[model samples]
Target: MITLSLIGIGSGNPDHVTRQAEAAMNTAEVILIPRKGAAKDDLAELRRAICARVLRAPGPVVREFDLPVRDASGGYRAGVEAWHDAIAEVWAAELADALPEGGHAAFLVWGDPALYDSTLRIAERLRGRMPIEVRVIPGITAIAALTAGHAIPLNAVGGPVAITTGRRLREDGWPAGHDSVVVMLDAGQAFEAVDPEGVFIWWSAYAGMDDEIRIAGPLAEVAGQIAAARAEARARHGWIMDIYLLRRAC
Candidate 1:
């Protein structure tokens, strides 16, 4: 049987790693890290740094694998499904090679697995192929970092908030019945699609990291600045991970 631990390491900050996650890393027989590409090498490096900090000498065996790139050519949903299947296959092969006898293996997840991350779904695909037991250790989410970074409350007292993706905001407009919206996975800066008249935006890139950047103001006054800033940051870093909160006038 394979004991699979999906440990959340938080948003690129080594200090964000919890004691539980640290203990799990030290106890696991193998830890698998995924290298997305040169552009996102810093992400993989963060995982490695976590291991270096927590794992003792002569500790668990460390393994690295290349992650499958998602195909965005077809419909978004269809492409994502295909990409997940590809990732599951890669994961199975790597795990099997690392533990031919079936042992404890861990994957350090970015942020919490229960959130927008797909590591949980990919792990589910391995159940039929092997006798596996899965465990999750939650970590601080990007939303939390964004809010904390800006020193703002997540919701107005007794008001509702919707957490969604950039694609949804652009394609569907703002969701109904929520005073505030927290947008994630917005590669295209979907905030530009909304009417900026009464909305306030608090945006952050690489939240909680050393090079973290933040911007907040009325949407109309600063939407262009946010866009320009995002462009510049992505150009400088080669990749960017960002999230934002939009609150409509009460």
Candidate 2:
């Protein structure tokens, strides 16, 4: 049987990597890194840096594989499912080749595996194709980091908060009964779609990382500023991972 460890190393910062995640990293015989072309190579580099910090000498055999791009021609959900299938195939082939004898392998995931991240779901796809068992080591989430970066609590006292993607937040507008919402995986400033009349926003790009940038204020006042900042950061870095919390006045 092939044992796979989905280790969350947090978002970008090596200091956020927990001892449990580090221990899990050392225990694996193979480590897989996904390459997302030149634009996002820093992601793979961060994973490597974390492994370098924790792995002992004569450590796990590390391998990098090109990640498949999501094909948007089939619509969002269908395209994501197809993309996951493609990723699973690459994973299965890489593991089979790396560990012909069947052993432990680990994939370094950003944030927690159980959060908005999909590494766990992709790993589940291997169950039918190979004899596999999966384990998770949780780490700090972008939400946790975002809140911490802003020195605010995740929710108000006895208030309802919802977590949703940028696409959903943009298309659905503020969820019906939610007083607060956390948005992730936004391709752009989805906040523009919101009414912004009585809402407040706390936005962060690369939260908890060394080069983190954050902006916060009444959405009406700072929405355009946040959009401009986000655009500048993304242009300079070639890529950006961001999350935000929005709260409506009581």
Q: Which candidate gets the maximum lDDT versus the true structure? A: 1
Q: Which residues of candidate 1, in runs, are more than 4 Å off?
A: none
Q: After superposition, how far is residue 16 of candidate 1 from its true place, in Å?
A: 0.3
Candidate 2, residue 174: how far the Cα is off, in Å: 0.8
TM-scores, all candidates, are 0.98, 0.98
Q: Relative to the true structure, how large is the alpha-carbon lDDT of every model?
A: 0.94, 0.93
Candidate 1 minimal-lDDT segment of 10 residues: 42-51
Candidate 1 per-residue lDDT over residues 1-250, each given as its tens digit:
8999999988989999999999899899999999999999988888888899889988999999998899888898999999999999999999889999989999999889999999999999989888889999998999988999999999988999999999999999999999799999999989999999899999999999999999999999999999999999999989999999999999
lDDT of 2: 0.93
Worst lDDT 10-window in candidate 2: 45-54
Candidate 2: give the clashing pairs.
none
Identify the runs in model 2 with alpha carbons over 4 angstroms from their true place: none
TM-score of 1: 0.98
